[model samples]
Target chain A: MKISCVTTFLMCGNFDNTLAHNLFYVNMETPTQFISRIISNDRISEGFFELSLSWDPRAPVPMPGQFMTVRVGSLAVPLLRRPFAFAGFDADSSSAAIIYQKRGAGTELLAAARPGDELDVIGPLGTPFVIDTDQSKHVIIAGGIGLGPMLFLSSALKSRNIPARFIFGCRNKSLVPDTKMFTDADPQICTDDGSAGFRGTVADYINTNVSLDNSTTIYACGPSPMLTSVNKIAQSSGARCQVSLEAVMACGVGACMGCAVPVVGGGYARVCKEGPVFDGGEVLWERM
Target chain B: MGANVDLSVRIGNGTLANPVGVASGTFGYGGEYEGLVDFSDIGAIYTKAVTLEPRGGNAPPRLVETPSGILNSIGLANVGVEKFISDKLPYLRTLPCAVVVNVAGASEDEYRRVVERLESGCLDSVDTNGSGIFGYEVNVSCPNVHHGGLAFGTDPAQVERLTSSLRELTKRPLIIKLTPNVTDIAVVAKAAEAGGADAVSLINTLVGMVIDVKTRKPVLGAKTGGLSGPAVRPVGVALTCKARRAVSIPIIGMGGISCADDALQYILAGASAVQIGTANFVNPKTAGLVSSGIREYCIGNGISSLKEICGVAVD
Candidate 1:
């Protein structure tokens, strides 16, 4: 009788690491694809998830700033799925849209996803920007796609009746999405080219318009360079700022540790574990 | 009737449910995956290494991906012992299996401080399923961010001293995690045994590096970090074999173990148990598959238990 058991074996009669406790894990094979219906794909803002989608409710809800590795091709050239930040989820519509730029291999595939084409959604993974209410009023600052997390956070704030403002900066007005989503706070937009909204950088706009009272807190996500600039602005302004950092993440979970940001103290922190969102004061901006 | 396999294996004063377990750092305080993974299914869940004071960890650029592996300089970022006990330990008590605390001390006194706190029986409380801590792993192999982690693990006397000092604290079984960056891994393994360690885990992480050719600077915050993943499995198995021959104590093997075939190699080479570290990144389900694979191998081979095959291939 052939019998095999996943049992601990003795090595030369010596025992291995002592058993500590019983651990239970779910075998949810994160499937690479899903069946869903697209309700609407509206270009809400320069970068927004205002589009409605109805898909497998069984599909996990996308976390804020959490990404999806979507398959973009019917061919083998772009074999791997491109990762994009999940903008938001509409339970009523049952659909989600990811905001992204036309970058390399997988991202180009994302831009090609037509209506009715089923998507292979892989995630909702990665440590999300943790919003703490006790800290202060939420001030969301975005540079380009950095605006993705703010939309969802704004909806959350609106539902909670929390005071929040959206500061979005892009290369120019053409790159900035429409203003319907920002109807809440009269979003302050800045384009480097002075093509639309406020002329100059977002940090410049924050310096000109926003005042840093003791109750002010900032949440920012965009280019690392922009985050660095925001980090300095928030520091000088003396506002508690949390920035959503983007790194090349392989396994978005804490495992890969590929997405690590420098901590201000002395050691390194796993962006996926310690935080995708970290207090600006705690990060070593100069080094990054 | 085929050979009766006995999965029950005894080392020091304790017995583990199986040989497959989680390594330190990779599996945070155990509860991080509690909702997703059954803490009891694994033979042991090694908590993050706790040092004397709370660690803030290294600056960014801490992790970089290599060909098939990863290099991380996380600088052992962890909430100090106080928060660990207050926040994380309560969850450990609720686990149905044993909780192995990985201890890392900047100084000898700090190690004692951590153990002293746990000795009060607070950590051994009844779990949600009513169970207590299974054991403690002295993670001496963790690379130091201050002086570099390889210094201590490479020195035999340091290994012995670190182990012996902690051995006097509790009667609980102790396993020393060993670094593979040294010239000879067996030397340190023997030193651990001499220091009264109940067991030793081999191949913590090979000191490695990856540099982006586009930029002159190296990847990873520290420039070099511990390499782990499927790329290192062969080396891990070989080291386990060498450590097994050099010492009489039990050996916990880990490195690039991703599948059942890889784990069996470690068992055949004399590792009593194995820890799945880097693979946890590829798939959270890898551990379960490995566990299931182990059982399947035993069943198909007509082996009744895991113990029957332990070190069966040793020459």
Candidate 2:
């Protein structure tokens, strides 16, 4: 379960010296079709569920911010795999977890899944967030189920002895994830109803309290609108920012070119390939 | 019963070691799925469509999932044939299986030019010991493009002219991929044969459109897209039967072939070989699975060769 950093960098060919660049270069090891066994599928809130699967130690460990395209059912009803970001992993137990809210037919089927069920998965696909070590302060932001990757990123950052603060924003107190889940960092929890922590949105909380400077690096994952606001704040304040994007993908690989997001420059970048994680400046927010 | 089944069969002048091959566009240049799939187990790899000039393809939302199927409006996005030859062909030449370049163009002359370049460089002289491409699969059935795709494929005259011209360009095997959008695929299949094509493959995606009720617009970037998957398998089988009765040449059957049973239906319908398309998107290892499954099926049925069952349903 211990991922050898030397082996990881060697496997990922283009490893530059900088920690941020090295994170981006983490080779998405050739994807394999793994028949993973579901260890637990627990409903945490009204609609959200935290599902964990026993992992094969041989399979490449998915880095924080990367995702897996999971097949919901044995039958081809949905036909396409639903992509989910890594929420957490227990190397000692050889299990990984994903947090999701029941939304469509795919998630509805996933909600019906129970422990001891076998699920087909292809991953650890897509790009991971680049953690800039030079930045003195790191801020992790999550919106709703976007907390999945943020929690995973928080743990990874902790392993590097880097300090990070978590800011979570949801609709109300009932929607917030268990505070015990984020024991490493005291989260600045915010709810729209003012029933839990801060009264405004996570962006509003950051705008009011957090100070962004050249030494600040912000990592955010959430709804597109929330990401747009955070991206704007990062750009205006001269702080480095990386955001994880979401899209409906047919093939998690680049062949289908289905999950494309327009970048700041001109052409489209495949979210399943070039990113699910991208620099705030690289993305064309309005175009998305 | 350990029956020694010969999955290998002849297509055009070339021979495939097995009947299962990955379809064009599904398998990208044979390099994308390298470590994920064992190339030695596959019969051939048909690369994504290559045109005379590089094409950017359609805008976002190029693909959407339907019930047991998928609609794609990729617009045949590919690196130009020149770049394909320079950048992709070298890696393809190293693969253990046969390689078939899927070529597309805006016009017949454009098709001829691409084939001429491929022949002079990649396909012309095959070192008996060295690895090289087996043939060319002419893609005239792409529904996403505006130019020579379905436009040239639907018309029998255009199919004949395009096929005949490309046939004259290279000694390598030429397989004309037919469009199901035509009124009668049999007529187009016969047209390809008349043009001296070595073989024909069908059915390309059926033209379909999905409307987003809330937005009141089509879901795909291209207003319409080609539909493929199990939904199109019956249509593909029926058309393959019709084309088999109409033409004497070999037929490559495709459309919604996800498992060995689906592939067996195509062989029984008259396909000498089968290609796995949209299923590749759903399962990257489908081709390998189908290959082993075919062998398992042949052994279970006590059939010694695939040719025994091919076209059995048609006769």
- Over 4 Å off, model 1: A1-84, A101-141, A151-200, A204-219, A231-242, A247-288, B1-6, B120-130, B147-149, B312-314
What is the DockQ of the complex in model 2? 0.58
For model 1, residues B82-115, the per-residue Cα lDDT tens digits are: 8877888888777765678888776667777888
Q: Write the per-residue lDDT of candidate 1 for residues A1-288, one digit (tens) a residue.
A: 000010111001112222111100111223233545555555544433333345456655554545555545534334323456656666666667655666565555555555666664555544445445565677888888777667766665555566788888889877877645555546778899999889998888888888875577888888889899888887777778878777765445454345666676676666655556677888877777
* Candidate 1 lDDT: 0.68
The 10-residue segment of model 1 chain B with minimum total lDDT is B121-130
Which pairs clash inside model 2? B229-B256
DockQ of structure 1: 0.14
Cα deviation at A84, candidate 2, in Å, is 1.4
Worst 10 residues of 2 chain B by lDDT: B121-130
* Model-by-model DockQ, in order: 0.14, 0.58
Instruction: Report the number of the highest-TM-score candidate.
Output: 2
**Once superposed on the true structure, which residue ranges of model 2 sit more than 4 Å away at CA?**
A1-3, A6-25, A182-185, A193-195, B123-130
